[model samples]
Target: MFGWLRRKFGKTDRFARLDATQFPRFAPGTVWLVGAGPGAPGLISLLGYYGLGEADTIVYDALVGPDLLAMANPRAEMIYAGKRGGKPSPKQADITLTLIEHARAGKKVLRLKGGDPMMFGRGGEEALALARESIGFRIVPGITAGVGGLAYAGIPVTHRDTNHAVIFLTGHDEKGGVPQAVDWPAVSTAAPVIVMYMAIKHLGSIAEKLVAAGRSPEDRLAVVSNATLPSQSVVETTLADASTLAARTDIPTPAIVVVGPVSRYRQTLDWYTGGENALG
Candidate 1:
């Protein structure tokens, strides 16, 4: 009987980082890392909704949906921590420190981020910082860009016949340029559906690496900008033509690139092409 108990309880420490009891109760002193989903307010999960309502202060990014912010308690204080590549913004360390300070004050702090907090949202850094300070916090997952944004553009990451696996990768590194650590050949051969974030600026070099890695130039590719938002736009092309098409257009950051046979689904499944909606 003791052996059985040891097996069950010994594994508990593996997930101790996310223990709910370690975190303060939802009364008035707690911190929640809430994902606002990818651009759309309706895409936010119920857990995100609950965190917003209980927030005493909300530190939000620029990408967060405005409609979602409206859901926050009327008395909640809002702080802007939006960071854009090549633009001036608050330092990440500063943001993390602020979260710690807010939580230490015994306030219900909500660090609202766009897309899933753990997916390229830098939530891990904040969580680590919080843990080091011995501050209790909770992480609430939301729809990430690779999943939610592609859906809004009528592109599925995987299709039963086309692909059984998908891979989400960032185009840029901490310095905001193409990442050199990525093994192009391995990724090219392994992942049928490849979605990139912040890679619009380096699309030319990225395409070259994939091509050298044996990814066909004719492979279907789609770039969805401002995904899931009213101002969303999509540029459809092949891997070889993607860089050229992007250069000629104004598609900016907050974009997602999908490459694979699954991209062909956009032709028929795209509901945003009717021009009746805000997406161009």
Candidate 2:
């Protein structure tokens, strides 16, 4: 009846707006908070795929891979919201405001973040800001570094003998420094395995804190640089030697530090057995 009504009203199609009603409409006033997953593009969730297709504007970060962006509609607007520590980058508030502005302008906004938006990705802040403005939003979760990166390295976070539990911590805090809020003593004592993100520069302080917390000086540690990338590198060290090991190595930023018994598994589990040709 509605189709006939529309056609009788001189519309070319039976239901001109059927597409919007049938498909998950990227409503003009809503923002889709999407996770791009860890470096691998195939790891993105189905909702992420849909959001990319439906979005009119996509605001992405540095960690997001280009493959995921390629899935966005050709006509979709793309914006870079990368925030590198110690580098000139866009403010968090500004990024949040951009989403609001795009949605207010009747654009379907996609706020794409790297890894799981809730896991150290700061998606909560953006969601809160959207809520304050009465903007409708959706969250699409993605695989986080704690699991995805470790898988690429062929290291299982939980092994029957090695570890029953794993703890993930950010090396950088709100100010992008080694987070002082973490109780190193408690973490070192309780967690069987520790994955530290953005803590390369502060390895010295972190190692010292771990040692002070009664962790063995020779406790195994592995720093996996550029995890899951072609240029990835892994260096095996110990709690006491972590600072020196990292300082001597040419590993770059965006590395993951695995500490505890699990770190020892990388010695044999590291399938990327190629020699250090680039570092040479």
TM, every model: 0.87, 0.86
Q: In model 1, which runs have C-alpha deviations exceeding 4 angstroms?
A: 1-27, 275-280
- In model 2, which range of ten residues has the least summed lDDT? 271-280
RMSD of 2: 7.8
Instruction: Write one digit per residue (lDDT tens) for candidate 1, span 1-280.
Output: 1222225346645434433433335645567998999988888886677677668999999898678887777678999999988789999989998898888888889999999999989999998888888888899998999998988888888889899888888988888878988988999989788999888888878988999999999998888999988788888889999779768757766789888898777767777654334244
The global C-alpha lDDT for each of the candidates, from Candidate 1 onward, is 0.82, 0.81
Give stretches of model 2 more than 4 Å off.
1-25, 271-280
What is candidate 2's lDDT per residue for 1-280, written digit by digit as tens?
A: 1243344346767445543554356688799998888777778886687678778999999998787787677678999999888799999999999999999999999998888898888899999999999999988888887787876776788899988888899887897777989988999888778888888888878989989998899888887777777767677878999879757648776788888887556556666544332232
For residue 123, model 1's alpha carbon misses the true position, in angstroms, by: 0.8
Query: Of the candidates shown, which would achieve the greatest lDDT relative to the real structure?
Result: 1
Which candidate number has the best TM-score? 1
